[model samples]
Target: MRFAPLSLLISLSLLSFSAVSQDTNTVTAIENDITLKQADFDSFTEILNKHLKDESQQQHQLDLLRARSTKLEKEKNQALDAMNALYRRLIEDPSLDISDTKLRYQNAVDSHKTNKEDIAMQLASISAHRKDIEKIRIDRHALLNTLEGLKEQKNTARVERLRNEFNRDGTLEIQNTINCKRTETLAACEQRGQHLGMQKATKRFLDQVFANLTEIRLVEPKRNSAGARVQVLNSHVVNSGFSGHGNYDVNLSVTMRGDANNSRLCHLLNLDNRFCSEYSSSFQSIYSPQQSSNFTGNVRFSDPVTVSTTYPEIEKKSQTYNKPVVNILNEPEIDYTHELTLRSNVHDDEVFIDGVSYGSTRLSVQLPVGIHDIEIRKLGYNTFKKIINLSKAQTLKARLVKNKSHLVSKPIVETQISNISVPGMVVIPAGSFEMGDITGNGLANEQPVTKKILSDSFDMNAKEVSVSQYNSFAVETNYVTEAESGKGCAYYLNGEPVWEPSLNWKNPGYEQEDDFPVVCLTYNDAKAYADWLSSTTNNEFRLPNEVEWEYAARAGTTTDYSWSNDIGSNQANCGWCGSEWSNKSSSPVGSFSANQFGLYDMVGNVWEWTQKTAGQSDVAVRGGAWNFAPSLARASTRLILSTDFRANYIGFRLVKER
Candidate 1:
């Protein structure tokens, strides 16, 4: 064989040394990685064990707290039963005035309250412990998974080392086989075959190791049960009365249990949980248990008063008056009747003779010729009373004084003739006016602007009825508004009307003073009010007919509005009427200039109910409201609504026959 060159021999030696060094470094690095991962796995395993031990301890504590809570609840119930028995015995036999027994009952009540508080505290503690246990279990599970991943990494590193070793040995064997010329030895061929077999076996082992790591799965933590208990206490109504025009005052005891979610109670009042919690805690600390606290405040009602002893929460309500008990004695009958005419400075003041309504003032009635007690009453005015002995036909006049405390507005100028002028009313002269859309640009309903004629004069309310006026009728007659009796009134929200069950005339989604025109009235409600007024005033009080309403609204004007063809500023309260209360709320009656006929709020403030019907079960509504646009507020505009439909934008004005 030819002698190899020195340079070639040196190159071969250097290449072999480089390959061995590379293999050695790879194996050493993989071994170091396995060592570090093994150490981390061991450390994490220890931490997971510690977390598991803590979780076990917390679970045990939770169990103990639950048991204690149950015991306290049982004891509290027993104490309550004992107190109830003692109370019943005392009530059954009032003769027994045993001080010792009373003391025992008081002690039992105190004990019950103490037990309730303890139970609450125990439950709170248990809840906290359960949370801690859940956290610990979660951490422990994560740690276990991390340990398994670290162990797998360690195994993978070892397999990588084995692969490196096989590569190095196979490379050496291949080199030796290349160096052995055409005539290869048996020993070299056997070594090459053995290296190939070893490489395939190592590859299979590494693949198996990866498969085992991929198959590892972690278990999820179990969920815990959550619950709470609620208990209501007995309540008693102490005092109640009509406190204001549309509100009442009720002094009562309210008791709320602690450690319970009272969201349901808050929902009943259409309030949030935070408000409920604050209200409940106002009586006593939530940490303290059952304690009866006295609550005294004005309770405004939109519905009938139905007080419950179990729960004394504030509800929209109206005052209920109890009829006075009367005792009649046998007496001789006097059978002589005479004509008696009643008159008052306030023309329509309600008159009562001998405690019976005899219609309004400027009224003629037949009364027995004897001593009679007479009383004249009007809203926003003091009552006028007198005792009269009438033997013949005579006119009795009483001057009513304005009640300063409940004054709604400056006294309206009274008409000169008491025989023809009614209080809060204006006499419209018989005339003809162009009804419907007098302006060329109006809706289809306003079309066919025809000439409407009124053959006879009629009296119409100068201004829409105020809250104070309606409240008087409601209080006297105990009439429940349709909005209050049914679902509720339609209140505007998000640029549209929404049915708000909690809103009514008393609370129409905004604050209203006594003088503000009453809204949230259905056609039936207006009819009922008119009927009541007629019965009390001895006049045919009813909603104005369509032709009459349009004629009155036009006020002898052929323009779109009473002032002009265009909606003038400060002329009315509407969406764009340029009034301060426009689009926000209904203004007080007479807040703006009146129409030509001296009638206020005929075109705005609130839609007026009319006697005319539009479609089946639909009644006609005239004018417009503060929440409506100027176009809707035009004198000729007309809208029809269901008889039972009520909203904050709807009200009424009455008309009396002349």
Candidate 2:
């Protein structure tokens, strides 16, 4: 959104063309092309953090104010108690120091005034602190946004030179498979990334995605009956592994014992899988019941790393069938050849049809009803080629004639295809839960509880949307909030809701971190942001319906509060809680532990807007805010406000439709 002057390091790196070496120039040139410039990026982060508006300082000041308010209230109460006691003594004695008693009473009244003045000044300072923090946050976002422009700079001369070098380099893409061996940690391997694929040789599951990829980095390259060596020839980082930690591409290769068909592809620390030991791995592997010369395989990946949508669970039909024998009573006259399958006795062998390599030994391909040429080859083995006429769905077994004389190695290749599930969303598995307030102690609106079923699973952001996230949306859309243009957000002033022009998501009438949920957004404002997000990400994101919101908030608990029935202090932000933030404003989301569903701030921080419309013009808001009493902060508590209403205590979370 905003540009910052280039840092001294960046400026120096850009200038002094004659003094800078060609290699230095080359590094600077490609820095624009890479996603990470480790050193420069790290330096920039340090600078940003150093200058970051520390909202916590303001929060600390607010805490002190609350403590001061409590202490003053106690002193005032004590003085009044002393005055009352003295008056009682004098009445009993029928003669006493009435002057002293009167003085005590007057002093108590004066103490009350002083307390009020002190608290007012404290509140004012807290507000100023909030303003300061927001400004710092604005600067922080603007600085971070500038990184894209900085990284997008291009030098035509350097780019051309780099391209020329890439063309001249013969060892760019190593077709052979490689393993990481014992080096599991990226740091341990000097940050060398082994472009891993399934190394499992057994064609247990033949899916086209895996079939198309040259190297299959298996879940367990060593455990598929023939624990082969997890071997990496060399770790290649454009230059070499030793120097390859930065943002650049590299090439590598690998091999192991046993038929490659039996192994699932994976990267090892360049150790022969046979020589390396097995460790805890992830994801299920597709197993082929029968190993055929023609392999039918399916593709799958280890978990934590997401599988791409392009590679759907389409099971490539590479099944091997015994040639049908003529049966007059049961068998059809002729099996029309429509689907064709080809396999190799050896794994990772190149299979070619019409001169184009299918990329692996065992492959399934659809052929028109006609004759075709198939070729299968592996290095150190004889090349296999054959011509076959197809009349029906037929499976062809290509026994590669061993190239006992050829010294060529097998090469497998597949094209590369590129969440929040962002970093914080958690998948709430599809399940039916009885919806509504189980405890009847809640509001009448939570009445008429019903048993509802969620037909489909959905994802919910673990934490409420933060200020930084909302800022990005606002910047991209050039959007303004209802509060900014309307009556402004309703904030507490002298113990009453008052519209303040300074009150906004950026200020939120309190000091808060970027991690704090953004507030003062109306229902329409929230919806507009949701629509923009859906258009941008092509994912259905919306405010949760009241029913879904309560279900997630309850997280399978029937308690009044998300944690349990008893109104516990420090569990949420509310007026009744004598916590540090009590009767002040929202805290950062997840300040307290999350509920059973791993959702943070489900019951407090702010009353989240739900999709449920109330009456004729209002929108439903749930989970009370910092200013509300604990009773209203319960999961079952329901409050509705006009569609135009925006307050420092109103915000919303996200639910992605699945």
Candidate 3:
């Protein structure tokens, strides 16, 4: 009997052992792949089920909105029919007065119009819910398709694996039969046939493994002949099997091609050498033919991933329906209040509405829709009283006649009038008042109320120093303000004072009209302006002392502010004081109601520099500016600023001594 060569048998035996090992590994890999694909399929199924549930909910919501819309439309039609019937009754009934019938018809018409709007809004909501339901259904369908595709892919992989196993087994059986016919014993024939089958299977596995290899590269550092480092670069290895499931240990033999002198070019060219000579140089480098690298790692395979699933959201709308016409007309209660704007000839006369003082005229108050007694009175004017049945908003102008008896008994002061001799100055009457925080809601500096008595009257500016007035002084004296000469004026930014090099009195970081108060002044600057004014007018013009400032600011009233203690709206131009220019910029002089002494902006608009000194280098400023809080605008609130400091919120008003 003829037998195979010893070397050939040994090679076949080794191939058989390798084939068995590879088969076991491949089976495990296929099982893992199938498991991952099944998990993906299950995940997609869960998403599809969830979307189906959302679709049901959305459909139910759509149905409810449609039903509500239909009900609203029916109610709208009924309301329209009722309105038409009411109109026809008004036209047919001759005994019905136009007034009573017209009111009822108007109510009915409003009810019908409101119902129509509600129906339209309901229909719009229904349409939106329907669109939401449609989108949910579409998403559900996509998820279902994805699940089916995953299932099909998983089944196909299983089929391919089973077919490969069957082919390998059948080839082994056929080889066994052929070898039995050629050999003497059945046992030897079976062994020989098994070896042949294994050889074929190994060949198939190696062919597949090599076919999947996309690239083979050698990556190492390049060194000079003297073993000194020269340059280094990177190389990459790519394999189609990277996307398959298995762990592999690949051994690579790299050989350098070309003459030893020019062997460095092999790394750049990526040339493959099969019969290169062994490198025997003292330097053992990457260029040696026998050098090999072993790369061992596990390649993880990923199945087709399920897409992110999101369900459409249904919009919820609020339901609003108009009250019935009968209910609206038969309602017994009414608003009963009407706005009454009261005016008087005297600018600062006290006004009383229903015996409740509503500050001074011109003012507005809401009076009940009934008879209200209105009273307007001043110190020397006859009390004007009126009784009016107010059912609607109206403006009442009262001209008070002078009470000769009161005026003669209590002689009026001459300080009530502005001093014509001193232009733009008002005579402030000498009076005794409790200065400081009489309201007890002020700062520490405003505490310890003290009674101050001014024995003499003084002529003070009726308004804050205007931009026009300061400009006149600047032009006449040809003087540059400290802010313009040195550092620019400080302005409020982000709730803190920031010194801007570009800002000055003329440009206080915001636009200012000529009539607005002039700000960004230091104590010395204000003193200089006062000196200039004193020289020009031949009067002693100077900053008011703190006591004089508080006296004039309080006027005759001992309240927190000149007008009242409440810091009422539209009374001043300070921050949060309820003026259009509050906290933004200084308003024009006399923009708000004046104090009782006919003084404008005594408590707000700008912090005025006073002649009083607080510390060695600090000067007292009275009132508050447009950017300060309302509390800071109190009559007694005092701010001590450095004498050389200049800011947008600091300005000055002159007091001319009489």
Candidate 4:
């Protein structure tokens, strides 16, 4: 049924009959045959490869869709939070005499509602892609089923062909060709003319070859190239009276094939693959049954004939499983009431937790029993940040070392900050206060409470650089920010910040006056603008260093804020400050009163970029933005950002150091 054992096929192929001087043609039609070609296998393999490629592409699409769904889920939660905050305010909001507070609240509410709808649409798109993934899986299963059917068809055809080749009509024709005379003289043939040894040998050969197909066809030596061999079906005709016993004769013919590379092994050890080789030989031998009266016949086949063939195991791909998505919207709060001792190799290096300043290293502090972000930093040395999992009180020690860090060049522009051409700037006298040091807020990195001095005086912008000025610069230089060149700057589209095209400072997803601070400017963009201003104005204007900015922002006062410990309404633009512009993007320059240094709009409008680089790709941003909480607006609060970071709440102002 499976391709017949090589020996049986060869034996059947050798059937022949000879009646007289000339042999009879036995295989008139039975010999003509169809065979499997190597090309057939090649074609099937190609089909398999094509299906595999399609399957791989579908899987890639599924992975991308899954990621999109996860992002949308996060946006949905953020939008809900924004809407809730507005609702709470609307209930207790005072009927103030300043502006239309109700209308402002309604507009913000509608914006969040729109954002939620957009996220829902994205989720729906993911669902469609998921359905496509299922369809691909089903199609792949069908391909496998087709492959199984093809194998079944090939095997069935092979069995039917073998049966047709070895039936009674085919055997009768062989007898005539081989001159095997079928007679009824039983006693004469068995007692006097039986060729027992010959009979036993032939039978044993057929039995052994048929029983071990795997060994002979796969493990043993073989050949696939075309060749032929002949095997005789019977002995020549002989009568018992010719001698003391009847003589039996058998004939044989053999042929072998060479390998594709002409290997001699294949030449000598050719296999009978139906299409690769064809030969037949009649059984020929001589023996007398009378001489075997006391013979107990025994026939044994030696080891299998070693064949040479190259076959590689076939491999199939298995299905892959993808884990379900999980959105972690909230984490359980930890009660960190106990204090622990922490020490560092250097005394002046700062420490931090969750990017907030608590105290410097080598101090006792209370932390949650879970994971906390611990960092130690110094200006010249590389900052070390780690996630520490604490369960109990323990003393932690750290070693800080300096890396090769390059300081920013001083501003080259020398024009008055209050020049009338652009938005005005403010002048602050040279002074110092523990580096504008403040306690009670920030990570260890933000906790440099030591009284460091600012020796040189500098002039800073009275307000942040505004949109109109930045746009003029962009048009003049024909320069594009990283976001514009790639995806756009991050804007609050549907409740959370997402990168959108044409969403740079020119269009920060909101209506704005020209005097409002430009938002979504990357650190490099701010630096580029400062250099341009220096070249254009013939003055040394550049962004302020972290220390210089802090000194001026503090305005010579050493308190939690530039004004008071508790910031009230109309003080600054912040999330909880209750200002008219709270959580509503940047306010116009000079919107807020000036600090002691006569500098206005310093606390909040947009987060200002500083000329300070952090341990990672981030630079320092100070003075918090309109959307951020009041704590971020504190004089000492600092946040790190990637050099190319661009968000709607971020911007920069310039300073002239002398």
- Give the residue spans of candidate 2 off by over 4 A: 1-423, 613-616
lDDT tens digits by residue: candidate 2, 461-536: 7888888778878987789998887767877553346678877788777788878889999888888888877777
Cα deviation of 266, candidate 3, in Å: 91
Compared with the true structure, what per-residue lDDT tens digits does model 4 show for residues 522-611?
A: 888999988878877778888888888888887666765665554434667865455678777778877865665656666877888999
**Candidate achieving higher TM-score, 1 or 4:** 1
- Find the candidate with the highest TM-score and give its number: 3
Off by over 4 Å in 4: 1-423, 492-496, 614-616
Error of 2 at 437 (Å): 3.2
What are the clash counts of all predictions, listed in order?
A: 4, 83, 0, 60
Q: After superposing candidate 1, which stretches have Cα over 4 Å from the reference?
A: 1-423, 614-616
lDDT of each: 0.56, 0.52, 0.55, 0.50
List pairs with backbone clashes in candidate 1. 301-316, 301-317, 302-316, 302-317
Q: Distance from true position, residue 452, model 2, in Å?
A: 1.7
Task: Please give, for residues 109-207, the per-residue lDDT of candidate 1 as tens digits.
Answer: 576566567657766765565455444433432333233334333333333332222122111101111122245443332322222222222232222
Looking at candidate 1, what is the lDDT of residue 286? Answer: 16
Minimum summed lDDT over a 10-residue window in model 1 is located at: 219-228
Selected candidate, larger TM-score, 1 vs 2:
1
User: lDDT, candidate 2, residue 588?
Assistant: 82
Query: What's the CA error at residue 329 for candidate 3, in Å?
Result: 9.3
